[model samples]
Target: MRLSLISSIRRPGFRVRPLLGFWHRWFGLFAALWLALMAITGSAVVYYEELGSWLNPDLRQVEVINPALPPETWLGAAKAEYP
Candidate 1:
């Protein structure tokens, strides 16, 4: 006698509630995972600058300068790099 898995699953007394329950559990897990991912990314976007500063401890503070650099000087440097 050969035992077939399909035959057992197709038995007339087998109930579908268990299969539905299994799928329901899986769907709930996926939905929760997707929501969690979205929430994490959304929070990161909302706190982008804060997150960057937190990640880079060194950049959180700068040495005090008596005089700030001129805007023209900053613009020149940016143009030099980008152009």
Candidate 2:
């Protein structure tokens, strides 16, 4: 089957409506500002996790104990609950 691009083909004599032209221009400004805000916020959100880790030292802090918990302790607890 052959697909037609009839609607995409521009008709030679174009009629421009005055009110529509005004509306387009009016909405165009708002659309541009909205897109700009989206771009800025999107970039900020992308780096937000990395920035948070860098900014908050408490979140990055790790408690160092002399010895780590033995695997037997976790295995015994798991067996007690699951078995």
Question: Where does model 2 exceed 4 Å of error?
Answer: 1-16, 65-83
| Candidate 2 C-alpha lDDT tens digits along 1-83 | 12446545645576558669989999999999999999999998999988888889799888887777899998999999999
Task: Give the candidate number with the greatest TM-score.
Answer: 2
Instruction: Please identify model 1 stretches exceeding 4 Å from their true place.
Output: 1-11, 57-83
Clashes counted in candidate 1 amount to 0
Q: Estimate candidate 2's alpha-carbon lDDT, on a 0 to 1 scale.
A: 0.85
Per-residue accuracy of model 1 over 1-83 as CA lDDT, tens digit each:
24677776577977799989999999999999999999999999999999898899898888886778899999999999999
Task: Estimate TM-scores for all models.
Answer: 0.48, 0.50
Model 1, residue 23: distance off in Å is 0.3
The local distance difference test score of each candidate is 0.91, 0.85
